[model samples]
Target chain A: MEKILLKNLGRPGFHTIDSCLVNGGYNGLTEAFKHAPESIIQMVKDSGLRGRGGAGFPTGLKWSFIPKDPTIQKYLCCNADEGEPGTFKDRGIMENDPHLLIEGMIIASYAIGASVSYIYIRGEFVFGTRRLEAAIKEAYEKGFLGKNILGSGFSHDMYIHRGFGAYICGEETALLESIEGYRGQPRKKPPFPALSGLYGKPTVINNVETLACVPAIIEKGPKWFSSIGPEKSPGPKIFCVSGHVKKPGLYELPLGTTMRDLIFDHCGGMLNEGRGLKAVIPGGVSAPMLNAHELDTPLDFDSLAAKGSMLGSGAVVVMDESTCMVKTALIINRFFSHESCGKCTPCRDGTPWLTNILKRIEYGNGRPGDVELLESLCTNIFGRTFCPLGDGAVMALRGALKNFRDEFQHHIDHKRCMVS
Target chain B: MFSDKAKEEIQQVLKKYPNRRSGVMDVLRIAQRERGGHLVKEDMEEIARILGMQTVEVNASAAFYTMYNVEKPVGKYHIQVCRNISCLLLGAENLIKHMERELNIRVGETTPDKKFTLSTVECLGSCGTAPMMQINDDYYENLTAEKIDKILKDLK
Candidate 1:
């Protein structure tokens, strides 16, 4: 499949507006301006593009939810807070070929009738931030932004809002709060961001990769895009491969590519020839992991869902047999414990407790019934938190227990890691 | 008190948003940078005055985010190694140990000369190049012991 998202990547000066225009960037916004905004939304809906930011929400459907009244101020936020443990694809887009994202954002803002947009980038991504800031400046200077963009009488202002090292800000609502100069904590849903967002006005939030697809969808028509991948989830997906893979990097393939091909063929198998695959976290740490037996699963929204995992952010973390499952669980839980926004009691309190128990087990001080105790704790915390952070921690621990229950048992009973 | 340059920068950041409160993070970031990598109580108070926000609100926003060092100052080089699962699987812990041994300071501790502070952070989105660390604002990826030694030695 042809690479739509990363097509301009690796070209010298691809991040510059001059190079981007030479490579046919901003053509989507020009094409979008020729049609009614509603038609562009419809085109996106027909293209079957889903939000690449974990939840897999449809992009056009999300845009359509905005109140059609043009008088009300609407905002579009590009979520660049790419802090998920094993996910790094968005960073690649923002740091390299930033004009692609800028063009996509312009097209999206135009489609949604948003005159203002913000790229809420993570503060740690200083380099990506500089690239995006420079690109936005270039776009404004080139008459692609500001008043009467491309003589279409549609004006949009884009700004870069740097997130101050809070992972919770990746959540759309929390991102809105952060932009409002408050603590980055999630707000209650039912009035989603599409309705009451970014200062209680209608807003649309999209991941960096999801918005980057808009230019291609408009320039090449919807059918050409929807026909590339599987019928349900059609598009070029960037899968970030890391961990014990021999060649770890970003691989852009059609959605629904099988995990076996991604790990063995694309990533060059395990870290070395002697090492065997133990398990893989098919998404970020938030998604349920898949054991080596489940390597045949196709990596997509629906397929991974059917297998009780998720294609979250398309981050595939490969682990070899030398990895101890118990230690893995402990490390993952510790991350959740540290990152859990203290808004939810169950998440803020329960994550540390989960980390504590996992640490005890990994350190060989675990007693009998600790494994069952963990199972009970997961049951209590799974559906009881304010947001998905608690559920993610529980799901990750449950996935580990489901596949490596005996390993946990051995750690408690034998006082050492089973593999190591 | 903020420097004239920082105040000018804060005003520039304020112009980007409709609400004055929306500029709090940028103001705090500027204050932290001006104060040499950490925010002081007086700095937060001054920011609240300038932005028409409560000092408690400024402090809360500063404390909520990890990048702002509200409590203690850091060294010239803040060496934060990624310890998330992907990096962990690639011997990030060994890298942390190596740094500790070389610096003669444990994790979260500044060196005796206050030149280097070693800390373990969660993923910085460089997972494809495992065992990575960020020094100040730069990323050093695909690390080895020799690479780390050179990186540390070359830093002024």
Candidate 2:
């Protein structure tokens, strides 16, 4: 299908504002200026655009949540802190075609009545950070940013806020706290960012890919975008295929594409011709894995959710038969444990506890009831944490056990990895 | 204490945020870079003084994030290998072992010459280019023993 998000990528000097302008970059902001902010939000609502950052919340609905009063201060935060394992699509947009993201941010800021915005990028993305800094400068020089823009009354200023190495900051509240120079920890909900965020004012936080889609939704009519993929989760989604694939990279396709086609047709199947496919993490490591038998499942928000997994961040990780499922579970659990912000008692304590058990099982010292112990631990931590970090760890481990309980049992019984 | 030039850069960064406290991340990054790859106690105190935050608050913020190397110093080239899920599935462990053997340093140690520090990070977000490592600010991906040797040789 036609690429909306990554269209500017791979073009010569695509990162430059001149090239982006030639490719009809700021046309969205120009189009946006012609319409009232309410109409733009309504147009986005009609487009059926969902947030690409794990949670598939409607982007228009999110924008509409901002208090309409013009006097109350509001801010828009573009979450460029792409720390989810196996997810690099945001990095691609930020590094290659940064202007696309900047333009999208400007339009989004206008729609949400945000006079100021921040791109909270991860600290390790030094190159992407510099690219965005230069691109923002270019945008400012062209009057796309600062005081008035394209004769429009909306005045917006965008800045880059680099986050230190904290995965929990990917959470919206944690991101806000990090931006406010506090420990990156999730706060209690109900007074959500839409109501009171970012120094206790109304704020709208969007993922990089989510905001990047705004320009396209505004440029092309909402019907055009809504008709591309499934009626519920429509739009061209960037599936980041990595691990045990022949062609492991970014593939922008319709959202409802089958996992089988994504791996076999798009990614040239698995890397090891002899071993074949073992499992596929349809989203990042957070989402539950799909065994080889379930490759026919369509990769969308609702479809994956129906099959006990969500299309989170569109990071499809394919693992071959050579991979030890037990080890894979252990590695995933270890990541969550390491990244768990010590805010909640259950997550802070339970993740490392889960990791310790997974480690014992991977090292062939698992007792008979270790799987049951893990299941119990998962149940305890699933909804008990301050955020979904603990739930993600449990879901990943549960997915592994659901498909490869035999692998864990084999390691326990045989005292060695079943694969190796 | 930061140099005058570093202090000026910090001032510029402070202007970007609405509140002075919001610039702590960038300020800490600048302090770390100025101190040659790590933050010392005095640097945190200086940042606290500049941002109008308590020194403990600045230190807590620094310790919460993994990128800030508090209470430790790094070499000229800080090599962080990706040992996360995607990288692990593609044999990042072997490449990390290769790096250790060549550098004569463990995962979190600096070399004797203070030229290279080998460490393993969660994920550098370059999983597509599996078996990747980051040297300072740049990414070195699709790595092998020969590539690691060549990169180390050039750095040395």
Candidate 3:
């Protein structure tokens, strides 16, 4: 119920230094500077906060990945390149409350012993980039970002690196490659960014919402933060509920909030009067879709995973009877096909192949074995590609097939789309 | 080669990078914008000549980025409607339909009047404001058929 992360949003001049200062921004950084970096990391660890950026990796564990040696110049990268199919929570946090993310970055930088941080934003977010740039300038002018911060002798500098609108750059390694001024492509992991990233030094990447929640966690002690959500995935998350809902918008809720609460209570249910819930993609297109029977599933990392999906990026997409599943899969497949970096074979070849087949099915040209072929093609692509993009595409196809098998059959049997 | 005005605009981008080669994309962006959206094959070659790089290099960079509209002539007002899962779930189909009917043009086609070009873009990062569309650079969110109609009328 408490509006911690979104408190400064809608406040007049919230992006400006004066208003942010008035609204208790940078207080966390000021307090954080007084303690050792290890202590701050420990506090975050105790807070039970997980990354809000789909993966739900422990924020503290990610920070601890940075090498302890002071000799190495570590980097902190903020994944503001929110290119997920159904996710826009990061854009809201970056645009409305820019300082929260900035402040959170500063605290996180201090905690991880990172001397430099970069907020790599998607190029399509022209307004968000401008707002964040202005906020960074304000932070620099007010002496919150540069050399001795609040007279604490802790030095840190931040920069905003604009992406070239590649969805692949949303992945951590690819983001680092793009920030380092190369074509955005994912590198092999195990170096895992913590060991060798961004000029081959230790690095840490956190989502915009993940880092934005840090200042609040630091300001409001670990216990208070831990008490809010479920035991494992504690703290508030920004769920960007869209599609079919009457009040489609961003809702800040606790992690364990049920799907019913988010879809019905918060988003004002489906828009049409007679239409009932057909399905829900709980976390972006990468996550598996849940049917109406699964509405009671709690919205958390573990809970969603237990139900064969993920809490990916907190992008809840609602569906009604009016929606067509075959068409939906085609739409999602088209996105992956267009955005696929083509670095890996499975994604580069498989996505378009899947899309072409789906298009055939949707256009009433589906063959007898097209549905089974789709299943086999998805099997080849899943877990075999370089990054999560291929996996996401495969998951989307499988999800459509699992829930809407009848539709695929109908297309084959009737030789036309059932919806049309 | 780039015009003097474009050269001046490119210098602003050059200031951000220490090396001139790093400004290749920026120079291409400026040249594309100066030419009013679409970049001809000659434009890419000229940019390479201006940046002192090979023509293939500039061409590759331009080709890699989706923002640059090369070869084809785009409409005066480019409307990129987000048709990904988020937007689609929120009636992007209806939004696309409204656009098609209002402008009398199909997706990937420019209107006969040359006043509107409707293209469906993937994920413009405003999914929180779903069923949204971007007119040129500015984002118009919470799109309805009525709001879209008014927006299109105002643009005219």
Candidate 4:
């Protein structure tokens, strides 16, 4: 019910630095500067805030991953490369409330003892990138970002690095590579960004929405923050509910808000002459599809996982009866095939193979054993690939097959998509 | 090859970078803007020659991004409809049908009049404002057939 993350959106001149200042925007960073970095980290940890980025990684735990030594020059990276198929919550926050992201970045930088921060935005987000860069310039001019903020002994510099339009760059390591002015590709983990990232030093990468929520967490205190949602996944979250819904837009609510509220109450139900809800992809295309029966399931990381899906990026994609699952799978598979970084074998080979197979099925040219081949190929690529991208591709294929096997059968047997 | 005026603008962009190769993306962007949408193969070769980099490097960069249309000629107004999961559910299929019928061209094809080119993009990061389409650089959100018709008429 509380509008913390989206507090300034839709308000007059909310994009301006003056309007942001009037609403106590940079006050959190000033408050944070007064405290020790470890104390700020402790406060964040106590707040029970998790990453609003699909991963739902614990924000405090991720910050704690950074080394405490002052000699080491740690980096704070903001994952504004929102390439998830259905997610746009970050863009809204970045465009309308750019200063909030700046303030959050400053607080996060202070918490982790980071001197420099980078907001790596997607290349296609031309307007959002310009707005964010302008906001950063404004922040620097106002002395909220430059050296020794508010007469305190903390100094920070922020940069906006625009991506060259690669979905793989949404991955933290790939984002680091892109920020370093290279072709975006995912790096092997275990060295994880926190331990050895961005010039092989300790770095912290937080999502745009995750960082945007920090100022409110800092201002409202941890107890108030923890009480908003389910105990494990507490705090407010912004769900970008779209597709088929009458009032399709972003809705800010507690983490455990049900699918019913999102689809029916918030989004004003499906369009197209009161069409029945066919299916729902709870968290972008990467997350598995849930039928209308699963609408009662709570929207949370664990809850969605228990139902064989993920709370990925909070991009709730609704489907109506007119959608053909086979065609949908083919379309989604094409994205994976194109976006795969080709770091490993399974994803590099498997995605294209699956995409080709799905394409054949969608086009009414599928062979008899194509379904089995698709499943086997997906199984091989699911966990074997280097990054979660392969897993996403595999999950998308398998989820489509599982929920709509009859459609795949229809494509093969009938030699045409059943739903046109 | 780029014209003298275009070349001068590109040189200013190149100055921002330490190495010429670093300016490859910016040069390609400027060149595309100069020539309208889509870069020709010759453009890539010329850019590589201008930047003192290998042609493959420029080609590779051009190939990686979806924004750069390397092969085809683009229409004056490029309309990219978001047909990913979100937009798909929000009558993107119907919208696509309407676009094809109105423009008399299929996806990835330009209208005969060279006025409009329609293509489907994955996501424009405007899912919050779903059923959206991008014309050139500006976004038109919460799209309906009537709205799209009005937009096309305005473009015409």
DockQ of each: 0.93, 0.89, 0.55, 0.48
Chain A TM-score across all models, in listed order: 0.99, 0.99, 0.98, 0.98
Point out where model 2 deviates above 4 Å.
Answer: none
Model 1 global lDDT (CA atoms, 0 to 1): 0.91
- In model 1, what are the clashing residue pairs, if there are any? none
**lDDT (tens digit, per residue) of candidate 2 on A47-137:** 9999999999999999999999999999999999999899999999998889889989999888889999999999999999999999999
User: In candidate 3, what are the lDDT values of residues A226-272, reduced to their tens digit?
Assistant: 99989998999888887888887788899989999999988888889
lDDT of 3 at A52: 85
Encode model 4's per-residue lDDT on A46-127: one tens digit a residue. Answer: 9888898888888999999899889998999999999989888998898889999999999999999888888888877888
Q: Give the DockQ of candidate 2.
A: 0.89
lDDT of 4: 0.85
Q: Highest lDDT: which candidate?
A: 2
Name the runs in model 1 displaced over 4 angstroms.
none
Worst 10 residues of 1 chain A by lDDT: A5-14
DockQ score for model 1: 0.93
lDDT of 3 at A419: 69
